[model samples]
Target chain A: MSVPLLAPGDRVLVKDDWPEFRGPAHIRTPHYLRGKPGRVVRVLGGFANPEDLAFARPAPKRVLYHVVFERPPLWHEGEAGDDVLVEIFEHWLQPVPAERQAA
Target chain B: MSTPARPESLARLDRLVAALIAKGIVTESDLVEAQARTDRASPEVGARMVARAWLDPDWRRLLLGNGAEAAEHMGVSMAGAPPLGVLEDTATLHHLVVCTLCSCYPRAVLGYPPSWYKSFEYRSRAVRDPRGVLAEWGTTLAAGCRVRVVDSTADYRWMVLPMRPAGTEGWSEDQLAALVTRDVLVGVALPRLPVALAAE
Candidate 1:
């Protein structure tokens, strides 16, 4: 019964220079989103942490959030036509003031 | 079983299943249930869901609100799988799904994902170039429409409830379901009213 983290439509910042969730693991957060700014779209529900699941270890459930990122901020190469919504874990995210958007 | 090229992988899978059974993590009945679930995976299930949604406003509201529940109501077992989210396509907005980290899919309702869905190029580019990718797939939206790319980076899997096509005033649910394809369910393609049933 952990407190739910990050509600829908809250702006959050992905930590900069944080190490990628390493292999020999089942991490679901994408590498490209590191240090990026996005808004939480919704709380996707709690699931046993996959990093522990990879080793058959008992995992405490963690809240997963669907965060929406502007295309231009994520990748500069392609046409900035769509907003990319990624399902990220609560541990990888931190809430930010709406005015201070980018990391 | 039709994937003959991976005998080694198949053997490895057998060994893993055997070990799971030995460890009491899963039983023979569990294995059978898993297989039965996979066996039932087909685009027909997705088509039926979409067709039902199109025909019934109450069903449509439920499907849009809780897709997994809607699937279960029709006997599509979603137990022990990720939550299902249906993104409805509209005149102004469209949705496309990709698993940038790995392949997370709504397997219970939509069956297996297409090979291209797991490719590195699709994973990397679909987020940035949805319109371009859809264009390459022969689907192009008209002016003023916006596209949204949903990355399945976690256990929350998404499927598209494609816009109901034009024509066919008196088509049956099965007839409408026939027009729904894996491509349409994934949002790369849109269902078209069969040419034979062209409307006035």
Candidate 2:
């Protein structure tokens, strides 16, 4: 198993790029959550990449993390302090800069 | 004896099952038994877990820590499914579960996903306006309470552990379980003490 790149309590930003698959794409990350900033709640271990598995290909394991984002950023009329916790794979996450971690 | 013809709608499923059986991956009996198990699954299985958690703190810890194992302890088999996660509802925090991408549910505990849960309208509105959705379902939280919308997007499935309703202090596990419904486990509703029980 590959060591997880991120840990719980780490603030990360969801990658805004869409996965480029030739055919029969099975992307798990919701389009709405892309580019959102969230804090990692837990390391949910590794699993065979669904993007590859959906096509019946031999896939490598990818680390999955439970991340929590405040609802205000996720929805226009979202309540303050209300949160949305989403399970995001490691490839879709990037470390939030030190300057922005306090936000 | 000969096998009866299967429905045209089941052609794709029949072919897939035949292929798996041909490859020795699984037998016809295995599929039958699996279907039987799935048919037996219901919200009552999940509600029992909730009721047990309310009565036993240790079991509650187990339920929150490892939901699949907790289900197995309660005689519910979670074989061949993703891990289960139980979201606890506190006095200050409430959880609402949605699959914005598609219907990914804890089938072993709660059985099949409700049709409304898979609708595009619900999928789009749940995260965008959870409070509004809950209000439509007749669940209004206190002003200070916080809501958490859980998106079951990946390999881990989720269910809510709703706060146990009051006025049933000495109720049995069966009685407590009666208060929990499929909607309550999904976080759109809360367990309410029945009027007769409340007056007891």
Q: Best candidate per TM-score, number?
A: 2
Candidate 1: stretches off by over 4 Å: A21-25, A101-103, B1-33, B198-200
Lowest lDDT 10-residue stretch of candidate 1 chain B: B191-200
DockQ result, candidate 2: 0.88
lDDT per residue as tens, model 1, A55-83? 78998899888899887778875554568
A5-97 per-residue lDDT for model 2 (tens digits)? 898999999998776555457899998898998999999989899988999999999999999998767776777889899999999999998
Candidate 2 clash pair list = none
lDDT of 1 by residue, B55-106 (tens): 9999999998898999999898778778889988898888998888877888
Per-residue lDDT for B67 in model 1? Answer: 89
* Residue A98 alpha-carbon offset, candidate 1, angstroms: 4.0
- Per-residue accuracy of model 2 over B139-189 as CA lDDT, tens digit each: 989788999999889999999999988787888999999999999999999
Give candidate 2 misplaced runs (Cα > 4 Å).
Answer: A20-24, B1-31
Clashing pairs in 1: none
